[model samples]
Target: MCKITSELNDLRRPSLLVDAANCGTEAYQRRRDLRRMLRVAIPPTARAALEKLLPIEADLEKRRRMGATTYSFARHVDILVALLAEARAFRAS
Candidate 1:
């Protein structure tokens, strides 16, 4: 007899999806730092929600909401490295 799988569970492969909530927590903090470093105005009280929302938010909207330009966030390769590193560090468990 042969069995068929009805669901695809790619997350089972495990690069980091084990603790999504925790990763989200870190991503949230990194986003806040990114906004602050870029001088984007974010309400102190809204930090948590913003952090939680940043990853899924469209890039354009995220930039608009944060008031950051591509020049500021990604113009230089160095900045991109730092930003990406920070993001990865935060998301890493």
Candidate 2:
């Protein structure tokens, strides 16, 4: 998981999950600072890919609601894994 997420999780409850950012208390303010830093640090080329997570989250929620699969949450974990891989690639480059 991302460092930001790891730290944030310790400050709150269950590990932060996509579509569950609103779960823990003070989620709004707690995430604000980290988001501010990310807005500045994230590469422009990667911004589009990150933006696409929103639609994907909606899709996951839809699947969960319709009982499309028992692994919808697992898919979210996969998404983070893929993102971490890409981020590692960025560092290597």
Best by TM-score: 2
Model 1: per-residue Cα lDDT over 1-92, one tens digit each = 11111111111212332243334443445455546544555434333323433332334334644677552322222223323344454444
> What is the lDDT, from 0 to 100, of the residue 74 in candidate 1?
24
Model 1 / residue 39 / CA error / Å: 3.4
Residue-level lDDT of model 2, residues 7-42, one tens digit each, is 323432125563343232223331342234234434
* Model 1 vs. true fold: TM: 0.22
User: How large an RMSD does model 1 have?
Assistant: 12.7
Clashes of 1: 0
Cα miss at 4, model 2 (Å)?
17
lDDT, residue 3, candidate 2: 49
Question: What's the true lDDT of residue 78 in model 1?
Answer: 25
The per-model lDDT (C-alpha) reads 0.36, 0.42
